[model samples]
Target chain A: MSDKKISTAVIKRLPRYYRYLGELLENDIVRISSNELSQRMGVTASQIRQDLNNFGGFGQQGYGYNVNHLYKEIAKILGLENHYSVIIIGSGNLGQALANYTDFEKRGFVVKGLFDVNPRLVGISVRGMDVQDMDQLKDFVVENNIDIAILTVPKTKAPAIANDLCEWGIRGIWNFAPVDLQISNFDVVVENVHLSESLMTLSYRIKDSY
Target chain B: MSDKKISTAVIKRLPRYYRYLGELLENDIVRISSNELSQRMGVTASQIRQDLNNFGGFGQQGYGYNVNHLYKEIAKILGLENHYSVIIIGSGNLGQALANYTDFEKRGFVVKGLFDVNPRLVGISVRGMDVQDMDQLKDFVVENNIDIAILTVPKTKAPAIANDLCEWGIRGIWNFAPVDLQISNFDVVVENVHLSESLMTLSYRIKDSY
Candidate 1:
C-alpha cells in the first residue's frame, strides 16, 4: 500500500468522501462501514473498497474504517496537510472570482499574488491583493516560492502564459482557459477546466433522456 | 452499434474528441485513423474504436475515419446542433463568474436566467439578464424550459438545492458544490466539480515526482 500510488480517478473522489465524512463526524459518528459510505455517496460498495485499498486497508472486514484515522490518511495523500502558495495569472472575471473565493485558504491553498496583462488592472486591488503585471510573474514566483498557479486567461494567450509560468518554476497549473497546451521538458502539470465543455455535457445528457 | 446505447464514459469523451476534431478541421485534416486520434487524445486506439463503434461504424477498415463526417456524427450524438437554455442557482462569486462566461454560447448553450436567495442580488443585472429571486425558479423553468441547472451554492446547501432543482424537472445538473447528491428516481445526472480535489491531485502528482 505504501508503494502503490492512487489512481487519478480515485484521488478525485477524496474530497467527496471527506465532505460526507465531515457531516458524519459533526453528527458524532465514530465509524462507518464501506457499505454505508457507498450507499450515502451513491457509489458501489466494492468500488469504495477498491479506492480505499489503493492507500491501505483502512476498514476492518466486519467492523468498518475509523472516522478520524481515515480522514487523516486522505488529507495526507491529498497534500491538504501542507499549505500551498498560489497565484492567479489573470485578472478577468474568473480570476477575480477565484481571488474572492474564501474556501481556498481553508483548503490549504493561499493566493499570494495576482497577475494581468492590462496596465489598469495591474495596479488595482482585488480581494485585498494588488494585481501585478505579467512582467513580474518570474520574480514573484521565484521570490515568493509559489508552487501552484491558477490560469484564467483567454484561449489564445493561455499556452504562452503556461510556458512562462513553467519557466518561472511553477509546477502546477489549474487552467480555466479552453485550450489544449503543448509543452516539453518541464515539471509543470496542467488541469484544464473547460466551462463550456461541462455545460455541453449537460446538454448532451438532457437531450438524450428528454 | 446502432442497437447499444452509448455509455456515459463514451459520451463524456465526445467533447474532448470534438475539441480535437475542431483543431484538426481547422488544420484541414479531412480524414484520421482511430490510432492517430487515440494517440493524439492520450487514449487507447481500441478504446477510440469501441466508443465510435458504439455510436456507429464511422471508420473504414484501411482508409480510417473521415474527420469531417466523424465530427458531424459525434456532434449530432451529443446534441450540439441545438441550443440549450441554462439557469444558474446561487448568484454568488462562482455563479457570477459562470453568468459572465460567454463561451457557452459558442458551444450552443445559452445562459437564459440567474437565480439567488439574497434579496440584494435578485433584481441586479448580469450578462444582459436580471438575476431573479428563487421564488420564480419554478415559473422560469417551466416558461423558459431550462434544460440544465448549474449549482454553485455552498456544500451544506448543495443537497437541498439539488433536490429542489430535480423536483423542478431539471434533467441535468452541473454541481459546482463539493458534495455528492442523493438525487432519487429521476433521469437527472449530476457532475461534481470539486475544485479542491483537482488541486489536491495536482499537488500529489507534483509531490510524487519531486
Candidate 2:
C-alpha cells in the first residue's frame, strides 16, 4: 500500500479522514460503514471507499471498518507515530502561537527551538522556549535532529532563511511566509500555508453564497 | 460568468491564479501563453484554459491572457475589490499576528476590531486597534457593519462563538480553530484554517520524499 501510487487529491483527503476517524475514536465508535463516514465527511460514500481502497481497503464487505484500526493506519501513513523534532525559524506572533500550540506534541511533532534575527526578540522566552539568534540556526540544526522548520519570517527574509534551512539539512519546511520559497534544488520538502489564499477562498465562497 | 456554477476545486485554484497573475503583473508581463502559465503553475495548459473559460475566457485564442486584465478579473470573481470589515474574535498570539498582518488590508479586508473574553486582554491595543470586550461584540458588529469574524478562540469556545457571530448577521467567518465547525443551519459562510492539517500534509510530503 505504501508503494502504491496515490493521487495528490487522495493524499489531501487523508488528513480529513484521519481527523474524522480521530473524532470517532474519541467517541469510542467501534466501526463505521463508508456511507456513514462519507456523510460525516461531506463526501460521497463511493468516493470514500475509493480513497480507502487506494491504500489497501480497510473496510470489510459488510462489517465496515474498525474505527481504531483505521485511525491507527491513517496515523501511521501520515507518519504521526514517528516523532518529528521541529524548530520555528521566526519568533513572530504566528511562530509564537505555533510554539505554544500543545496539540502538535500529542501528534508527534515536538518543537525543539525558536529562532529570530531581531535582537529584542532573541532573548525573549515563549512557551518555556527561549528564542535563539538566527546565527545559531545551522549549528542548532546540526546538534539537534530537526525534522521540520516552521518559516514565519517576513516575506523579504523568507527565501534566504529557507535556503539556509535547506543548506543546513532541514528535511521539511512548513512555510507561513507570503512569498513562495524556491529551494527545489535541495532535498527539503515544503508546504506553503498562504494565509491570504485561504482568506481569498473564504471571500470567494462568501461571494458565491450571495 | 458570475451566474455560472464553479466547482469548489476550480474556486480553490482561483487564488493561486490570482497570486501568480499578480506576480506576473508586477514583472510587467502583459501577455502570457497558456503553456507558459501552465508551466509556472504546475498545471496542464488545457486545465488552465478550462478554468479561465469557466470565468468568461479571459484569454485570447493566440495572444493568451493579459496579465493585469486576468488578475483583475480573478479579483472581481473573488470579490476582493469590495472591502470587507473584519474583526478577530480572540486576541491570542495567532489573533494578534492576524490583526497586525497589514497585507489583508491591501487585499480589501479591513480589521475593524479584536474581541476577547479575558478582562486582561480586553481594552488592550493590538496593531492600533483596541481589543473590545466579548459582550460588546454584537453592538460593535452592528455599528461597524462588520462582514467577517476571524475566529481564533479556543476550540472549546469556537462553536458557541461561531453561532453567536452567525446570529449577529456576520456574512463570513475565517475560522482558525482546530475543530471542524458544525454550523450548517445558518446562512453564514465558513472557511476553517486547520493548521494541523497543513502540518500533516507537510509530514506526508516529507515521508513520501523519503
Candidate 3:
C-alpha cells in the first residue's frame, strides 16, 4: 500500500465497496476487475482505479484484485477493527431508537450512553441503557472515553449540543439534525445526516426515472 | 434557463446550495457569485457554474446571481412546492422517532402512516398517528397515494418489505437497513442510510484530522 493518504470522499465509498465485495466473496468470487466493480458501484472504471490508487495499487494488469485482501485493507483504513464507544445526545425518539439499533454493534460501533435535557426521560431505560441527564454528559464521556457523539437533538439545540460534545472530548459527530454547526481547533469530525435532504434526493431521482 | 437537465449529483447538491442561500437571504445577501457558493459548498467554482448552467443561466457574467429567486427556483425544481405523503415500515424505535421528527413537515414531507408486524404496536398512536398493521400497507398506499416509504425494518426483512411497497405502487424508499435491494420497473429509489457506513466515515475523518 502507498504511504500517501486517501481522501475522505474515497474513504466514505470504501464501506460501500467493501459491502459489495463481501457479497461477492460470500458467493465465491476470487477475483474481480476494476470495470466490474465500477459497474456495480455505478461509477466509471477509471474513477475506481483512481480511488484505489490513492491507498496504493490494488489489481494487477491481467489478474484483477484479490477480494479478501481488498476487503481487509479497506476495513483497516476505515478503523473498523476497534469498537467505537458512542453517545447519543437529546434522548428523544431518534436517540433512543439509535441506542436500540442492533446493527451498529455489527459495524464496530457501540452505544455507550444516551443523554437528554428532559428530567422526565432521565433514568428511563431504552433498550438496556438508562437515559442519563445531559448534565452528566461530561462525566459519562470522560468515564467511558466516548469518541463518537450522535446528534439526534432538535435543530434549535444542535449547535450548542455539538459544542458541548466537542468540549467533552467527543472526536466525531454524526449529526442527524438539519442545522449546520461550526467548531474550531478540535479533532471533531462532523458528518451531517439530513433526512429531508435524503428524501428530497429520492424524490428527484423518482421524478427523473420517470 | 437552458433546456438541458442537470446531473443527479448536481441536483442533490442544489438543496444544500438552497439552504446556504436561505441563510444568505436572511442576512440580506442579494447577489452571490459562483466562487462564493463553491467555497460554501466545498466544490470547484467551475463545477458550481456548470451545475447551475445546466438548469438555466442563473449566474450573470459580472453581476453574479439573485439569491432569493435562485433559492425558490431550485425548490420548485425539487418539488418542494407541495407536501408529500410518507409511510414508515416497522414501527420500532427508529420508525417512531422518524414519525416524531418535526423537520419532515418543514421540508414538505408528512409521515402519514407507521406500519409494523407486531400486534401490540399496531394500534398504538405515536405522535398523533396510529401505527397500522403491515397487512394494511397496500390499502393505505392506494388510498393515500404514498410517494415515499421509509424502510427502517431489519436488514433481512428490507427486501420483502420493499417488494410489498413496490407492489403497492410506491416510488421512493429511504432505506435505513444495510441491505442492497432490487426493485423492478416502478421507479423505485432506495437511499441506503446506513448508520454503520456513516460511523465508519466519521472514524476515518477523525483519524485523518489528527
The candidate that wins on TM-score is 2
Off by more than 4 A, model 2: A1-8, A30-36, A53-64, B1-9, B28-39, B44-50, B53-64
DockQ, per model, reads 0.58, 0.78, 0.65
Residue A181 accuracy (lDDT) in model 2: 82
**Candidate 1 — which pairs collide?**
none
The superposed Cα distance between candidate 2 and the true structure at residue B146, in angstroms, equals 1.6
Q: In model 2 chain A, which range of ten residues has the least summed lDDT? A: A178-187
Any idea what lDDT model 2 has? Answer: 0.89
List the candidate numbers ranked by TM-score, top first.
Answer: 2, 1, 3
lDDT of 2 by residue, B22-67 (tens): 8898788999999999988889999999988886766888889988
lDDT at A136 for candidate 2? 92
lDDT of 1 by residue, B56-112 (tens): 667889989888988888888888888878899988767988887766676777889
- Give the clash total for candidate 1: 0
* Among all candidates shown, the one with the greatest lDDT: 2
Higher DockQ: candidate 1 or 3? 3
lDDT of 1 by residue, A1-210 (tens): 497757778877887787677678878888999999888888999998888887677789888988888887887887778888999998876788788777678768899999999987898898888999998889999999998899988878988888887887887889888777766735777777776677667768777776
TM-score for the first chain in candidate 2 comes to 0.93
Docking class of 2: medium
Q: Interface RMSD of every candidate?
A: 1.8, 1.0, 1.4
Highest-DockQ candidate = 2
Q: List, residue by residue over B1-210, the lDDT tens digit for candidate 3.
A: 555666767887877876788778878999999988777767799988877776566789998888888888888777777677898998988898888777677778898999999998999999888999988988999999998999988878998889888887888899988777777645678877877677777877776776
